[model samples]
Target: MTITIDGLSIKKKEDFYANIKTELNVPEYFGNNLDALYDILTEHPDRLQIKFLHYDRMCAQLGVPFCQKLLKVLQDADILTIINQH
Candidate 1:
């Protein structure tokens, strides 16, 4: 299933990670960190379609490094594609 995250609305790192945890149904043991997020996405059993809306806004809020990390995670996962809408 495809999951869309409203990147524009996410202004805080805490909120962004929290939303990821909820939307991805990450386990309780899941660490709320970029590394953990990467692990979850890479190991996810189901085919995931991740779409980021208003990606520019997200980048502006989260900074380039965070966005870069996310992109790398998605790239490594292979099963998911990032459809970033400008």
Candidate 2:
């Protein structure tokens, strides 16, 4: 799957952060700060499937439409495809 920002998929920040961490065999990103996470995302926009457990809830509280920023699927041949807004 693909995340699009203005048809570019750049606005989905949280999703990208999670994808890279997971792909790199690092621990799942867990923090209370979205701004910090957003900053991290700015560094890598190619990765998909990031952790946004807190951001989702906050978006719900703020009446913001939080789309599926992070997603992962095991396709054929053990392929792990992480999709984020990009």
Q: Top lDDT: which candidate number?
A: 1
What TM-score goes with each of the models? 0.87, 0.24
Clashing pairs in 2: 3-85, 3-86, 4-9, 5-9, 18-50, 19-49
Model 2: worst 10 consecutive residues (lDDT sum): 70-79
Q: What is the C-alpha RMSD of each candidate to the true structure, in Å?
A: 1.5, 12.1
Per-candidate local distance difference test: 0.82, 0.36
| lDDT by residue (tens digit), candidate 1, 3-71 | 888887789788788888888888989887878987898775788888888888888899989888888
Q: Write one digit per residue (lDDT tens) for candidate 2, span 15-84.
A: 4445444444343554423444444444444544333334444344333433322221222112233333
